[model samples]
Target: MAEQLAQLADDRALLGRTSTAERVSDILRSRISEGFFPPGTRLSEDSIGGALGVSRNTLREAFRLLTHERLLVHELNRGVFVRVLTVDDVEDIYRTRTLVECAVVRGLGEPPYALDALAGSVEEGRRGAREGDWKRVGTANIHFHRELVALAGSERTDEVMRSVFAELRLAFHVVDDWRALHEPYLARNHEILQALRAGDRDGAERLLAVYLANSQERLVEVYRRRVGEDG
Candidate 1:
């Protein structure tokens, strides 16, 4: 808890002054997505509130917001903890991803869309791969998809997927083989980026669809077995 508190202290500057629930929730959400608050980890309101220099009410509201996002859960007497996603949750998340991500690609009005962020995320994955940091690779992979979704230029869509992807990270934590989970996506991300750079929207969309489908299958299978073992 001390380490977590220290980390939150470092991030406190992000809140600036007059911390609102939205800003507090954003910090907590980013922390959860980064695996700082892994699944089933209980959140201490007092500790976190003190760490961020926010009031108890403000911190509770932030927890409430994240609960709505499926990143946190409140138990009657046990306090809030990061959520442990079920296999069905994993499947539903991917279904949502497939629908939104593919639609974003398909709805692209023209070629020569902004490709810089996408290219950067692809390169980020490669750098992580070379460094043997599979967790970093996974993060970069998520960034690649986030950038892909950004192509839609819809703030609403971005807001929705932010929660979805954070929820997806919970599923990712269940996997023991991070490399097996993230390594394959590096080349695939580059492939999609190349296609997009060449103005091959159809090809990019096709690649993204297949990529999401394959990822869903692999992740769901692992989740099922892991959940069963836990049960």
Candidate 2:
């Protein structure tokens, strides 16, 4: 009986180790997205590993992956923390997104095959927002923009936009009121969809440009306000 119990314990432990890595990744991602783990919060391998019941090695691997994606930054002596998005970072990301998304719209002589996907993502965003699932709302928002960019007909552009979008997700974390920050944009998204559906690419492009600029300003304001409060 003791041997059987020991075997059961081992099985549970193994299962936990596997599960812990996935759970830890999700937890860290959500916290980063929610601004709970802000820029420059030192990530101690031993502490996080213990907290998540993951091996130090597994945690390090996770850090490395995020670091590669530019979501986390690693310093030689200071350790890893969430990447801080600066003013320049915001400008660059917005510029790239605007350029890419505009090109995507221009490329559309008529609505591309991906219009349905974009519509679906908008609905997903609305549903997530209605359910008060801000995280899902954020995910849907990213997907919607990503699908728009994909219409540019370049795989490489999509890849670059994905990376930028991930960093933007981190920036969105700075907003204090999640629903207030994201809810207002849902209708604007639907409006863009309406224009696109009518094959009004020029109008859609103009609206997208304006929307992205406003979003950047709002995000920057929130970040500055938060930083000032903390200081």
Candidate 3:
């Protein structure tokens, strides 16, 4: 565990220059997304702080931020644990994505559509799938969506969408067929990107809406069972 934490601490070069608390939060957030801290896993401040070489106060602040983002939860007496999102949560997240992401594509203007981040993410997903790294593929998929949101040109929306994806990841962790679930989306993403590249905003938006709707439907059932929700 210490070794894994040490490696996580070392992977922050991509995180850029953030505050100490934010750096710790970013590491913890990445770990959560990677399934290092799976749903309901208790976050031991002592172990995490020691492993990351951070102070207690800073770790606590980081924990608070994640908690606020719905990635972590603070129980009355049980301490902090990774959040376990439910079916309703998944549905709500998809609904939010439809509103934000599809809206971006619908409102897109001009031809020089900045495709670097979006294209890069699709390629990343393809590489991850080739390597049998389903988790990496999943992360790249979220990155693709986040980049999609950026197309809307609103920083506030991007910030909100990030939290939405973090919560959605909790539900995704419950899926058993990771490869079967994520592999098909790689091509779907490329198709959407192609539609955009061809200057077909309506086509891209339509594909995105359908893509998100289908994904939400599939995840809803898994999450319902995972959270033991009654029919």
TM-score of each: 0.96, 0.75, 0.90
Best by TM-score: 1
lDDT of 2 by residue, 55-87 (tens): 787778778777876788998888887897776
Better of 2 and 3 by lDDT: 3
Q: Write the per-residue lDDT of candidate 3 for residues 1-231, one digit (tens) a residue.
A: 666677766765644555498888888887898788889888888887777777899999999999999999999888999998867778888999898898889888977699889999999999999899998899999999999989888999989998998888888888898897788899999999999899999899889999999898778877776678753
Query: How many residue pairs clash in each candidate at the backbone level?
Result: 0, 0, 0
Q: What is the lDDT of residue 160 in candidate 3?
A: 96
Off by over 4 Å in 3: 1-19
Candidate 1 global CA lDDT score: 0.92
Q: Any idea how many clashes model 2 has?
A: 0
lDDT by residue (49-119, candidate 1, tens digit) is 99999999999999999999999999999999999999889889999999999999889987788999999
- Cα lDDT for residue 178, model 1? 97
Question: What is the C-alpha local distance difference test score of each model?
Answer: 0.92, 0.75, 0.86
> Which candidate ranks first by lDDT, i.e. highest?
1
Give the Cα error of residue 71 in candidate 3, in Å: 0.7
Q: Kindly report which residue stretches of model 1 are placed more than 4 angstroms away from their true locations once superposed.
A: 229-231
Quickly count the clashes in candidate 1. Answer: 0
